[model samples]
Target: MRTGLLLTTLALGLSTTALPASAETLHLFGPFKDEHGATAPIKGSASAMLDTTKNTLTYRFEDNGLSGPVTAAHLHGPAADGQDAGVLAPIDGPYTTRMTGTLQLTPEQVKEVQAGQSYINLHTEKYPDGEARAQLTTDLTGHKHHME
Candidate 1:
């Protein structure tokens, strides 16, 4: 009886181990090049910690080189260059050069963001409307995502 109990426990443990691990973090990098009026386009990197279980994303951005003060920043819907869409989260920045924020996403928001339906953009004083932008898409193509 004891042997059977031990085997049962071992089987349960093995089954649990086979469960897929949740994705807790995502590293995203791309360039932000907009000739519309940017200082000359800048490259930036972003890292996000996603609480997939909770549907939240905390991200940080580092714009290695850029000019002028940031006027506005936001996470937008997934779309290519010259495409327009609504905002996902309003980043609390336009501060200094680098920006970071912890954003809580609703179920629908999480679904969209995970589906490669989100991008980030920064507006500068010189380009009050918006000068730099980067769209996030699946890396299945093995091509580096770019910020345009």
Candidate 2:
């Protein structure tokens, strides 16, 4: 038991140093089950990093296992429910669902994320519009783990 505890502590310490607290990632997951009250399968994972010193947000996203072809994808503003009323980052590609980009946040934008105000959405061919979406919430507790 003592050996196990020691190993666990050592692992945690090493990982914490590898991924500093200030540079830790915000793991985000959302299953886009529906859009406009219709059933759809939109599954994806994203990693978000907020540079407090620079007030910027760097995002790395990927959405595969989609029901249909990808049309467009983007980051959006806050909403109680998942919807496309807000779009922040636009993915670059055609017939592809993967996205990667960095969004320079304004002071107001930083406030919005801190206040739980951001989301990611993907559009597909079958939907021809929106298929899946997930909102980003500030993670101070750090319980959210890296997406599987």
Best candidate, TM-score-wise? Answer: 1
* Tens digits of per-residue lDDT for model 2, 39-81: 6454555667766546777766666666677777776775654
TM-score of 2: 0.62
Per-residue lDDT for 29-108 in model 1, tens only? 44455645566747665545556666777776666455677778888775554575688888875475666678888878
Clashing pairs in 2: 75-88
- In order, the Cα lDDT scores of the candidates are 0.66, 0.61
Please report the candidate that would top lDDT against the real structure: 1
Provide TM-scores for the models.
0.66, 0.62
Candidate 2 global CA lDDT score: 0.61
Each candidate's clash count: 2, 1
Lowest lDDT sum, 10 consecutive residues, model 2, at 24-33
Which portions of model 1 miss their true places by more than 4 Å? 1-27, 35-39, 64-67, 138-148
